[model samples]
Target: MTDPGMKCTRCRQPARFRLPAHNAHFCDPCLDLFFKRQVQKAIKDYAMLRPGQEVLVAVSGGKDSLALWLTLEELGYRTAGVHLCLEMGEFSEASLQSCRQMAARLGRPLHEASLGQLTDGLSMQEIVWATRRQFCSVCGTFKRHFLNRLCLELGFDTVATGHHLDDEAGRLLGNLIHNHLDYLQAMWPVLESGGDAATGFARKVKPLCRLEGAEIRAFAQVHELPVAQGKCAGSKGATLLYYQKAMDQLEADMPGTKHNFYLEFLRQKAAPPPPPQLGGRCQICGAPTMSELCGVCRMLAQARQWREKRRARLAAEEAAAPTP
Candidate 1:
C-alpha cells in the first residue's frame, strides 16, 4: 500500500516519484534502483542479451534512449551507441551533440550516420518530397535499414532500442484499430534476425519494453542524463502521436490499463502466422523486399530521377532564354 504523503516505499526518505502502474512511490535513490531493476528484469525475462555479446544501442539523444544506454552500461553490458542524424537541421545537430555527450560520459564509442550520407546528401524532407511519401514512413524505413547495416558491419550481435511499455501499448492499440495483423504479430520484446545475414540485419531487442515512458523520463531527469529535450520537428500531428494521446487518456481513466494490455499481448500463446514472404532481395540495394527494390532503395532511385529531370528542365529553360 502507498500513501501519497508518506515516505518512500523502500526507504524512509521523502517520496519523489509515484509509479501508478506499480502502485509504488519512491525517493530519488529508490526510484533509480527500482527503474534499473525493472530494466534488468525485462532483459532477463526476454533473454534480450547474452553475456559478452556486443550490442549497438540506437540512441537519438532522447530521454528514453539515453537512459537505456546508461542503464545497459551500468549493468556491465558491452554496449556502444549509434546516432542517426536525419538531417533535420538544428534537431539533428542537437541530437548528435547529446549522443556525443552521453558516449563521453560512459567512456564508450559512438557511431554516427546521417540522412545526407545515406541518401546521397539528400535531407529527409528532400527524400519525402522526391518520393511524395509520408515523412515518418520514409524516415522510419531509412533508419531501420541504416541501423541494421551498421550493426552487421560493426559485428554487433544485437541492436537495442528504447521502446517502452507506453510505446508498445499505443502501437498495439493503433494496430488493433487499423487491423494491421502483420505488424501486430511482429511486435515483441525481441525479434530474431531476418533478411540476408550478409547484409547485417541483426536481431532486435527492447530491454525497456516493460517500463513506462514517464518512468524512464523521470529516471533520466533524476540522473541528469544528456538527452534532447524536444520532439522531432516533423512528428507534429502524426498518427502515432494521436494513438499515444488516446492511450494516455485511457490509462488516466483506468490505472494500469496500458500495463495490462501490453502484458496480455505478450502472454497470449497463439502466435500469429508469419506474414507471406515478399519475394527476394531488392535489385538495387540487396535488401529484403517484395518489390524490385526495397523502399529505401526505391526512394533513393526516385529522388535521383527527380533531380535529373529537374536539372534537365532547368538547363532547357536557361537555353531557351534570350542572351542574358
Candidate 2:
C-alpha cells in the first residue's frame, strides 16, 4: 500500500513512490540515492567486485537491468552493457534499442551477441517448436554459453545481471519444492569463477538480489528510464512467475516478507558440496561440459537435424503426391 500524500523522507518534498517494507517514500533524487546505496551495500556485503575491475552488465532491456547499469555507472564503476539479441522478433529489437538508449545516456557503447549468428540462422523459437522443448530451458542454456563466450572474448572478468530479490525468492521456492540441492548450492549473490577452463562462466554477480522487483521498477519509472514494455512471448505461464506472485502476495499481507525470507535462507543454508567434475571439454566448442558437446552446440546440432528431417519429410510427401 502506498500513501500518495506522503513526502520524501529525506527532504520532505513530494514523494514519487512508497516502499511498504521500509516504511518510506522518496522523490527522484532520494530514490536515485536509495538505489545506489542498496546496490553498493550488496556489493560490499558480498565482496562481489573490486574497484577498477571491468564489469559487463547483462541487460535484458527491462527496468531492473537498466536501473542496475545506471546505478553502477553513477557509482563510477568501469561498467559496460551487453545485450544478447535472441532475434526472436520485436521483443529482441526493442530490448536492443532500450539497451542502446540506456548506454547512450551515459555516452558508452553497448556490446551485443546474436542467437542467429551463433546458430547459423536458427532462433530459439525455432528450436523450441522443432525440438519440443520448453522455451526457458533451451534459451537459458544458450544464453549462459554465449554470455560466457562473450565475457571472455571481451576481456571482462566480471559479469553482473539483474536478478532481484523477487527472482531469487521465486527460485528458492521452486528449488525447495523440488529439493534441487544442486541448484541451491549454486545460488549466491557472487558466484566465483570456475576453477578450471571447464567452468564456462565468468565471475557472475547479482547486485540487485537484495532489492524487490517492484521497487526497482518504481525507480525506473520515476527516473524515466526506457524499459522494454512487455515480457517475451515465450515467458507466459512460467512456474517461476507463479512463485513470484505468491511472494508478492505474502509481502502485501506482511511487509518485509521477501527480504527476510532471502536473508534467512543465506544465513541457514548448509555447506554446499563441490560441483561435479566435467566429463571433458566439448568436442565442438571446447567448452567445459559433461557431454560430448556443449549445450549451445548440442542445441544447434539438434535444430539443424530437425530442419533437415522436416525438409526430407516434405520432399517425400511432395514426391508421392499426384501430378498437379
Candidate 3:
C-alpha cells in the first residue's frame, strides 16, 4: 500500500517520509537537512541569536526540546540546558535522566533545579493542593519564574524554548476560543523576556517555530535523540490537549491550515496596550510582575499556609484519637 517509487522533492532519491503539509517528500538525508534548515531560517529571520552569545535552552526531555537543543548545538551555538525537576515520580526521573544524557552527549553543562528545593521544600503536588489551580498553570508559573531567574543569574544572552508550529497553532486556537485577545497579541516567534536585570531582559526565541510537531518527532527518531517518550502525568486531560486534537483534525482535513493561521496571526497581531499603571517587580520574589506579588510568590505563600494548616489538623486528629 506504500509508494515505493516515490522520489524526494529536493533530490531524486527514494522518499523516506511524506510531508503532506508542505506537499513534499524527502529522503533521510534531505529530511534531516530540511529540519535543520527550517530552524536556521527561523533564527536568521527573527535575529534570535548573536555571535558568541550564550543561549540557555529549556529542555523537558521531550522530542521538541531535545530536537531544538540538538539542532542549536549542531548549528554551532553556545548552548546549555536548564531542566526543572518537578518530581512527578517515575516520569520525572526518566525526564531528568534523558536530559542528563542529552547534555552529556552534547558535552554541554546541564543545570537541574528541583521544585521542592526551589520552593522551600514544597513539591509540585503541594503547590497544586494549596493553590487549587490546574496543575499546568502552577507548573508553568514556576518554570517561567525560575527559567528567567536562572538566565539572569547565569548571564545567558538568550533563552530558547521548544515551541513548534503545532504548539503555536494550538495555543492560538485556545486563545481565540477563550477570547484572550491580549495573549493572542503577545504570541510571537521572538519576545523580550520579562526578566529584570541591568543588561535588560534576556530575549526569548523559538527556533523551531516554523516546523510542525510530526516533522520534529520524525527528525528525533531519525537522529536517535534520547527523548523521553512519556507524557506528563498532570497533563492527561488538559485543555491544551483538546485544542491540539482539534488543530490536528483541522490540519488533516486541510493541509497547511495550521501554518497559514499561525503565520497570519504573527503578521497582523500586535500586543495589547498595557494598563495605565506601569508594571513593577514583585515585593516577595523581586520578579518582573504587574502586581504587588508575583504569581509564583503567591502560590508559594499559599503552599506554606496549606502545609501549616495540614500539620495542625493532623495533630488535632492524633490528640482526639482514643487509646486502642
Index of the highest-lDDT prediction: 3
User: RMSD in Å for candidate 3, one decimal?
Assistant: 2.5
User: Model 1 over residues 1-324: C-alpha lDDT tens digits?
Assistant: 234676787997888788887878888899899999998888877778886567899999899899999999988898999988887778788899999999999999999987787778777887778988778878888888898888887888689999999889888999999999878878888877765556625888899988888899789878999887667887766678788899899888887998889888888834433323536778877776777888788788888888889889999999999995
Q: Write the per-residue lDDT of candidate 2 for residues 1-324, one digit (tens) a residue.
A: 346688998889988778888888888789788888998898987888886667999998999899999888878888999989999688888999999999999887799888888888897888987778888878887887888778877888789999999999999988988999888887778777764543455778899988998789888887799999867988877778988998999999999999998878887764333434556888988787887887778778888999899899999999999997
The order by descending TM-score is 2, 3, 1
Off by over 4 Å in 3: 1-5, 194-200, 270-278
lDDT for model 1 comes to 0.84
Predicted structure 2, TM vs. truth: 0.93
Candidate 2 ranges with C-alpha deviation above 4 Å? 195-199, 270-279
lDDT of each: 0.84, 0.84, 0.85
User: Which candidate would rank higher by TM-score, 1 or 2?
Assistant: 2
- Check candidate 2 and list the clashing pairs: none
Tell me the lDDT of candidate 3. 0.85
On a 0 to 100 scale, what is the lDDT of residue 33 in model 3?
A: 97
